[model samples]
Target: MASPAAAAPSTRSVRLQIPRAHRGLRDGIEAWLEAERDQIVLWAPVAFGGGIAIWFLLPDARGWLSAMLSCVAVGLGGMATGTGGRLARILAIGGLLCAGGIALVWWRADRVAAPVLARPVVVAFTATVERVEPLAARDRVRLTLLPDAGAGLPRRVRVNLATGDAPVGAGEGARIGLRARLMPPPAAAVPGAHDFARVAWFAGIGATGRGFAPVTVIAPGAGQGGLRTRLTAHITSRLDGSRGGIAAALATGDEGAIASVDSEAMRRAGLAHLLSVSGLHITAVVAATMLLVLRLLALSPWLAIRLRLPLVAAAAGALAAIGYTLLTGSQVPTIRSCVASLLVLVALTMGREAMTLRLVAAGAMIVLLAWPEALVGASFQLSFAAIAAIVALHEHPAVQDWFAPREEGWGLRLVRGLGSLLLTGLVVEAALMPIAVYHFHKAGLYGAAANIVAIPLTTFVVMPLDAAALLFDTVGLGAPLWWLTDLALQILLGLAHLVANAPGASVALPSMPVAAFGTMVAGGLWLALWRTRVRWFGWLPLAVGASWAVLTPAPDLLVTGDGRHLAVRVDGGLALLRDRAGDYTRTMLAENGGIDGEPALLADQAAARCTPDACAVDVRAEGRAWRVLATRSGYPVAWRTLVAACRSADIVVSERRLPRGCIPRWLKLDAAMLRTTGGVAVTFAGGRVRTVRTPGDRHPWLVPATVMPFRVARFDGGREVRRRALQRRRD
Candidate 1:
């Protein structure tokens, strides 16, 4: 045998055996990290955003004392940042900022919330209409109402009014009086679903209900909102046809005018953003206005030569953004886009090249600080994700090469332009993929191709005609322009229908767990905010999150908030237990689990035997069974149903009170239990079942339900009561 020292492998030999790819990757990461050391500061804002998101998901603090503790944490974080090295100081500063952010949101929520009696209360209230949206049904208008003083309402409340005969348009301000039954905002439809109540609380809305009678217009022209309403009405009337609604939506941001079919089509085709007043529309308007102003001023050589043309154009662009914002009713997204544009214009005017990342960060910061609750909403998340991803990836060497311009003849140039559009669409779709799937549980398979075709048509033809139509109407010369707008809209709608109807146009995905979504967000942020090759580490969480989402199991049964509606998974489809075909929530849940079409159409998919008194689902495919029963409290058969359900069903759901004699061994959720849970989702696998509530104590927006007093105590002031007491004492 060889000597022991020679027989053992030398450490040098092991080092020499390392793979070339692994060594190269390690070296690249280190080099990138060293080169981009200073760019680490950009991550601070992302940390601040994390704080906002964390606070938003936290349940309402137990009391003011917890909020005060949050304040103390903020002060401590500030102190830590004061005594540290450069890296340590940066981390401390981010922590301090995060604590401060949490405190700010907590204080804002506490101050803004207005308590409402749980029971319905009828009141005659006078309020200003901050905004109005017409319902798809045409019979109602949803009004964002700001009550006059002493209305005993929050700063804002949404009320549904029956139009009766006075059609409500996009009027932003008109004082009106209404008799309405107001109740606390509705809770989440299912446990862990989006919490509308929390959203309403942060939005300053205390209550919501239908109007008891027709609204009275106390002051028709008192507020500035009527102008927008009139403009929208004029546009809709002039373009009157199938495409008129679409034209109005683009021109006035009155999306309610679009029919349900058209709306769904656009959404499925991934062209929904084009229908809204967003950054793209605002940017287009700004550029066109700037060019027009510059050309007009250049006609006078003295003005053009003496004045800074670029500065003047930037100022004009800012003004155009403001005008567009107002025209679109100053919705949150429109205002946010305006803010971003203004920031860029101001930077340009000051002779500075605005950094795209800085612009995005500033815009996001402003929006989040002003409306912290928006951090939890899908719109805010999706919009920011798109912008941030684009800014982060656009500078990659690979991306630069892909987007490089080429010199070509006219025909070749046309082909190149089309190819560029397709690439852009692909990039945007990729950026938005996670968010779209997490929120909507579906992604358009044909989205990239649809956008490639639709975007150019909308940007070049439809929007330009819409602008011309608006101008013509304003100046009393609109009929022809309106006709042209209508024609362009028809073409857009046809494209939407075609793409939406294509084979494999969209794919349904299972509901992503909250943890998986959060991990993906963190990964995306890590990649976007860092400039080091170390950023490649982000791929780890992203890959893991995607795998988790793909492997997550779907719930076996789902119940609605009121416990009146339910769905059971059978085969691969959901069997709806309710009578109606269009319960929006149920339909959404079904589609999320890859089920489509009406409940009646999917009847054969489930082995459900339902009678008037009870329904039983015998899932032969999975060898599982469940039963549900509903009864009026006074009916004797209600007791029978309960007893039968307790004895025979794997799960029992009772709409009325439980009977006195039944003790159920199976999972049983009653109306009383659902009142607290809001909704419930149950999953069954391998003879075991798990349940999750929709509402939880962890969400900051959720308001704990108050315990109602059993009885009212009062002092008696009646003369007969006093006399009877005195007489009884004397006797």
Candidate 2:
């Protein structure tokens, strides 16, 4: 054996020779450098152009200038790094110039239209209806406020109308003039709720209008035109006499035209997405277009050139998709699909392979920067997740063979199709579970099953029939197609109805806090993006979030019916209303607090025990108690009773004016007390007793009691006093 000193020399010798042994590493580094140089030359212009566009779109001048300066810094840094090529320098300079141009345009636009800085004025304006829908029993109409004569008039205003009339169409631009309140557009609800304000901003709507007036239509303005209008009109005509309008809605994002019953059926089945023009619809359209284009090319040798044909077809399809997107008002899901399609078209135009993952990422980046708030929207998150899953599954090697069928056997095709459907369902469901739980507080357990059946039927039978019917209607041959579309719609509705009524169709989850929702979304996104098995770690946060939501405590002080007894939220504790009526109110309170009690018994006991003049109040638990002074006449006697009660009782309350002799401990029940009719509350150090007048007045949800002052309570010395002069007048 060699001595320790000898072994050290041997180890040193091996270390010294290590670099020589791996001489190929140096060559590999050189090769990598060469490849990077080529890549930089290719991507330099694209990156520079994108940066410039970003800088231009920045909302503030300071940001725009800073971004422009960053371009210069990047160029200098490239030069200092000693790897800057002629292409890199040229790209940098081009980027800076583009940024400057963007800034100039922004400045010019800003100067041309100075910000309106006037107090919100009530103005009488006439608007033309663009879209209308029922929102929570009220009509919310989006309209274009037609200006009398102005170069820069606010383009649109949303009107909330209290009309019992039917919904108006986009083509029927009714002139609605009203003296409406105007305000600056509000930020989107829930951070990512659809930014109608931004959409209106793009359309030139600076102010929103409310209320309605009798209106007339001057003439039919330019209705939706081009293929979009034609397609929508065609579908509408075909589905006119159909029992089920869902098919037409599924084919075109026109749920407004769908019957309420069919719409509810689909919603219950969790197949409402079928009616919306989403990723599934867009993909179907794209696939159909591609197949038709390929077949037409194959049939015609004269136009079957390998070059430009595919690109041209893709471009046409993309344009059609974009038109459809606009026709559907460019909802987030539709916009996402269009963006992905456009990316694919660009790749095809450049003779590059279009990868789904890359397209999804690019679409996401674009949407986030353009509408950062969309990150919180359910549609944005779910749409992208579904598309990403489909793309990934489509690329998997195990399923690659299914794409290329050896023989067109019915069984083989059916199996392959089913397999693909299952794959898609599993992937999308897994990806969206966290989001569904977080935002909706409910998960459709059978969503995958419903989608499996409904998606294929929708793509193959319903949409095609609807589209064909629309096409036939344009050429005066729609009578036969109409019947066919109707049959297809009925079948679709039946499928939805069956699935919705299936056992365990959906499960309600507990509501989650906003922070937990954010965490869940972040974790899920991380798992989706991760390339390793460690992705399973995402489940930890999801489980934690679910647990937190499930364990959240219930709220306190749930009062039901008008001036009824409060049902203490404690288990088995029951308080009955002074009035024996108002079961609806009692039930509402019970539901709100998860209270268990017999309302009838409590109400009977309360009514029997408490009289108009003298009421006996019980205190089962040691706490403050309230006494209401009741009398047939004379404020002096009532005031004396109230004063005596206040000595022993924690609080004294009266529906009538305070007696002339009594003084209040606390004068004037504040705005907070007005919210609850449980009588003016007298709170002790331990507990509170509320005294509410019977037959409380009803107020609208928006109106706050802070604007009103209590007329009954008056301060006299250190006590409350009510004048007998007013009491005798009432008697």
Candidate 3:
């Protein structure tokens, strides 16, 4: 038998091995739990289903469906890997097969439906105005058509019309006939430009129309009887003459009352968002309403308890927010914010943790389901991105540390406020830069600075006063509020002018290449979602964008088409020709092609300048050099010598073509034409030519065959050299 000591050592080793095995098993179980935690549940699955449905319903939906289904397959694979053994293999194979089946069904449905869906047709119909606004120079109106007019497409149409003599209101229904052109909304304007068509499609618009010519309102009757419309009209009508117009515009999205010039000034000043009812505005209004209601409830403890005061107040605030959203015409972005806020509120009321990511996803799902096209809109993209970024930033450990421990004293508070503003401005500006460049071809370099001053003013002073004015107007004492609003407007306008005038304030950037823009967006998303040092790599796009802006070429020519003057690029120098004597032509020429250099006058007698071989003349160059006949009183010898040197010049460079003299090739006096024979001719109405032709075609060669009226010649080594009168001496 083995010794007792030897047996003891072996038993100890076995016991140690058992504990290690147990520990490994526990670790594996914890990981499995974590993975399960990450899995989609509840609303996530619903959203996933909606995405799948959209993929199935839209054209080219099979690809999108395949991509989404692949994610499911990936999850299954990940699960199987952790399970190991025979069970894992079986699970993987089964999961893949299930995914394949679903994909096949989607594909089959799409193929079958593709032929059955009729290509939308253009037809005349009556439509009710859902939303209307001015875009560029045209009026863009979204209208819902009558359902049973036998137009089997959809209930809505986006109309781009000339804002005619009639003033249109949102709730008004019109009995006007117009042609509806039906087509799929474009994906984007210039690759990365927001796709409005996709947005319109999801909003239930199958067609777009132009004009109110065939469109006439049936009556000024209340079109859609909604609480939102009623509130909008009420607020707008009451705040009509008040400076609270901007406030009402911001609160209710009634921009019609806001003057165009004022609106533009606010935008340039970086206070444009204040005028729109966005997430920030909605949150503020809700918070304010909740506080007021809570304070009232707190005053009566018994009533508060009986009414479930907090919950009741929250519900009221929710209703108010919804009404506000509708009053603001319920734009996709506004509605998205409303839904997102409501989700957060409901989560709070139910005592469930409302994760930022979850709320964002829910909001996205709502928007996509309602208007699948909104996924491509700028307002949708920027609003969501800004919100998501703000949420992420607030959650960041570094940011939390800096802000969580409140600063004491006024000086410290001011420092904190300024720091917060700077950080927020930087993040939002960075987030929106790429999209702004893509759409506008210009980036506000000083936008961060503008926001630093404007955001605080707009939020703290402008919005509050406007809101107060609206409230006061509802009663009858609106004058004070209106005056304050006017003062705020003036301050805003001043800030806009100051910022707009700043050096390098607005830099015109070249439109980004589609691939580059897509890459940048992907990089940005990675930076936001991924937590690592690699996030810094997102700056690569900024670098690339800067380089592109620096390298963009200038336009070849800039013309005003007013027929005042012509600026021609001749031999790398700009030549100015004024049709009439005035400073306008000279000033315009100086600014042509955005060149801000000294004006070199070619026609003014006192400032006339030219190259050694060329001369300036008051008379225009008309006919071909060989055919220009000099007047009898001036340059007779030079004229005879010029005509003798050439015989075939039959062209006339003039403002008006003369019927006499073989009807020569008439070149317009103000036009710049590049002749194949290596010479350029500027002409006048009297058939005068100031031709600059070099010895060879490479240098500027003149072909002479018909006739030359004025010339001076010199013979050097058997080669005849001729110099024509580029200038006409007055008789």
lDDT scores in order: 0.69, 0.53, 0.51
- For candidate 2, lDDT tens digit of each residue in 163-230? 44222333334544455555545322221122344344344455564553544445444454334444
Backbone N/Cα/C clashes per model: 12, 11, 21
The RMSD of every model to the true structure, in order and in angstroms, is 9.0, 12.6, 17.3
lDDT of 3 by residue, 658-697 (tens): 2232232343221232222112322233432332222232
- Across 1-731, the per-residue lDDT of candidate 1 in tens digits comes to 89998999999987877756476765665566557665666665676666677675555555333644564565466566553334444545666667666766777777775654355566777788887766533556778888777666655678876665333432566787777767777776654455678777776676787765566777774332466666666666677544767776777778766777788789889888887777778888888889999999989999988999888988999999998899887766777788888998888888776647778888888887787767777778877777677666666677667666777688977886677677767777876788888877777877888888787788888888878878886788877977787777888889899988888777777567788888888888878777767788898988888889888777777776666667777766677665654657665657555544544422343466665455667553355444533331222355675676676666666665565555555566677777666666766665443333434554433553322112222336467777776677559
Q: Candidate 2: where is the Cα deviation over 4 Å?
A: 1-124, 128-156, 160-176, 179-213, 217-220, 223-234, 240-248, 259-261, 305-308, 348-355, 393-413, 553-731
Q: Model 3: how far is 116 from its true place, Å?
A: 16
Q: Number of clashing pairs, model 1?
A: 12
Candidate number achieving the greatest TM-score relative to the actual structure: 1
Ranking by lDDT: 1, 2, 3
For model 2 the local lDDT of residue 489 reads: 68
